[model samples]
Target: MTANTRAPQQERSRATQQRLLEATVECLVEFGWSGASTTVIAERAGVSRGAQLHHYPTRAALVLAAVEHLSERRAAEIRAEAAALTGDPEDRVEQVIDMLAAAFTGPLYVAALEVWVAARTDLDLKAALIPLEARVGREMHRLTVDLLGADETRPGVRESVQATLDLLRGLGVANLLSDDSHRREQLLAAWKRQLTTAIREP
Candidate 1:
């Protein structure tokens, strides 16, 4: 087939995939994992059940693909913000902290939260999630270092950065159940002060 002939077909495929993945996230966020079944997802995406199965094969595959789709979007956003970093070291630190804080409070995180909860007892989902989550964790660690301008060679700097992520994840969990913007802001401010103090002693 000519390139022109294939272009529309490829574009249509991509659009269909995106719609299915988005519907998956919405279902997971709105109805939990069991509710986000392949049939419902296909219905929500306005695609046929056969099309959804052709792409995902199973519910676990569908959910994981949706997670991967969300991950790429976030990674792109973080890289853009990292590139735009400016100001004094303290400013960079605070800005990055706020960026990280914003990451945990959104719809994407809520969708991910449901997936994690459902994965607890679902062996197939757990198997897929473990490897994908590992890959994402590594990428996030890299982004954290990039955002922090941290000398990973320096003692404890890497661990401190990891601690920042750990703390944020905890706060993200807390925010799921409570209005934690005020608490998160307070903790983020304290973390920034502590990070500044720790990294300034070069």
Candidate 2:
């Protein structure tokens, strides 16, 4: 096979891989991570099981790819939202928190929670998820620094960002598990109050 002849085949393969990855995310959201099967994902993507296997020979491989894809897409959306904010640092921070809260109530959020639960018992899942978690932390820190005009290099600023990220993660967990909107609102309000205080303090 000549190099020129192989280029088109490579592109088609990449496209198929992307479709499979997208289908995996959709399947994970529609069916819980534990419930999503290779056959189901293949059907969802309108591909044969053989084609799916060509892209991802193992379930873990598919799950890892899906997580990576989801993380990248979510990070892009969040950074775009942050960039579009036109207000005070505090307002931007609130907007970011609100976006995060909304995400926690969505299907992707449920998939993420499932991943976290599985990660507790599965070493491979844990290994795959750790980088995504760290990327989230790094993005949060970058957002805090950009919006608040805080010097990330400073010890105190780093500590503050870490605390804020911890609070956000905790809030996400609460929002995911709770079904009561009023309760979620109350908790979110409290969190906002705390954030407001932190941002406004001299």
Candidate 3:
């Protein structure tokens, strides 16, 4: 009897934590870091302030957890999209670039940017973010290499992969102010051609 009751309570706790983390991301997107206070996040999650603190004792903790949660979800989505690609090597490269560009301009990226900017001055947040960012970067780079079927042992192949990510990230930044989609599309097209050449082995 006690075991049955405990299992349900544990499940409910997990559900509530998930809601809080998700709400934190929404708050970051809508309000930016400064406005995404604990109260606002708790309210957004439809949970009490006490519950928010119980799950995440501080604003930085909450925001970081949210970013990490959303990042994982985004990575899974990218993986699924990658798995669905059926094409020639060059075609797959083009599709991967397009997929990455779309991801960089999405809401999760915006929330991450907010946290990144805030972390620039917040030592605690910066310390926490460093490892998470490194892990995410390595995962993205590895996935890109795998999807492109690139021979990293070949000269310039690894750098080309890194450059592709950097370019998409710059475009994502450009998109923050206005609709940079027109310019982004053109730039991506040109880069895709260059990337195709750069990643192709002799």
Candidate 4:
């Protein structure tokens, strides 16, 4: 009942929620969707089943929250890297492309891929994921434009930005089966040249 006691309880609840989200991602990556049950995630998080349900209620909820949580974290990291870029503006553009490339290949992408595949057959999950994906995609596009100082008003500039995202997403899909890093770097290098030209044209 005391304020002090309530604060600690709230902090612990947040911590548990965080742990469950992390564990859901890990389960998806390691066990796939069918394997990432609520029970499994709770066990992975070292939290009780009751606690896990209290936070997320269902597997889809947990997985979606995990994806959203990690997506924000990843985007924040990209923004921070963009802030720290030095040297010529053109060079900074290249760095931003590389940062976006890294985002596609990271753990978050891997976990989200698992969910994407599962959502193909699960209507409830597909419904939840559609809006989340749309929002994340918009944020990424906005972030990319901001990082590149791109003028969407310019002809082809918006398309060029969208193409960059499409390219990165394709590369991420290709990377699932094997180490596509070498091929990915080659493709990204080529796309950067094209993107730079597209966005820079008068």
Ranking the candidates on lDDT from highest down gives 3, 4, 1, 2
Better of 2 and 4 by TM-score: 4
Q: Per-candidate TM vs. native?
A: 0.93, 0.81, 0.96, 0.95
For every candidate in turn, the CA RMSD to the true structure comes to: 1.6, 2.7, 1.2, 1.2
TM-score of 4: 0.95
> By how many angstroms RMSD does model 3 differ from the true structure?
1.2
Best by lDDT: 3
The model with the greater lDDT, 1 or 2, is: 1
Q: Over the full model, what C-alpha lDDT does candidate 2 score relative to the true structure? A: 0.73
Off by more than 4 A, model 4: none
User: For residues 55-128, could you state the per-residue lDDT of candidate 4 as single tens digits?
Assistant: 98877788889989888888989988888898687897799999998989877888888888889899999999
In candidate 1, what are the lDDT values of residues 1-202, reduced to their tens digit? 9999899999998999999999998888787767878888899999998888888888888899999988788788877877888868889989988888788777777888788888989998998899999998888888988787888888888888899988988888999877899978887888999987776667
Report the C-alpha lDDT of model 2 over 1-202, residue by residue, as the tens digit. Answer: 9999899999988889888888888888788777788888898888888888888888878887787777667667767777788777667657766776666566666666667777888898788778877776586577656655556554455676677667656666766656756776777777766766665565
CA-lDDT, candidates in order? 0.86, 0.73, 0.90, 0.89
Q: What lDDT does candidate 4 reach at residue 150?
A: 92
Q: Number of backbone collisions per candidate, in order?
A: 0, 0, 0, 0
Q: Give model 2 RMSD, 1 decimal.
A: 2.7
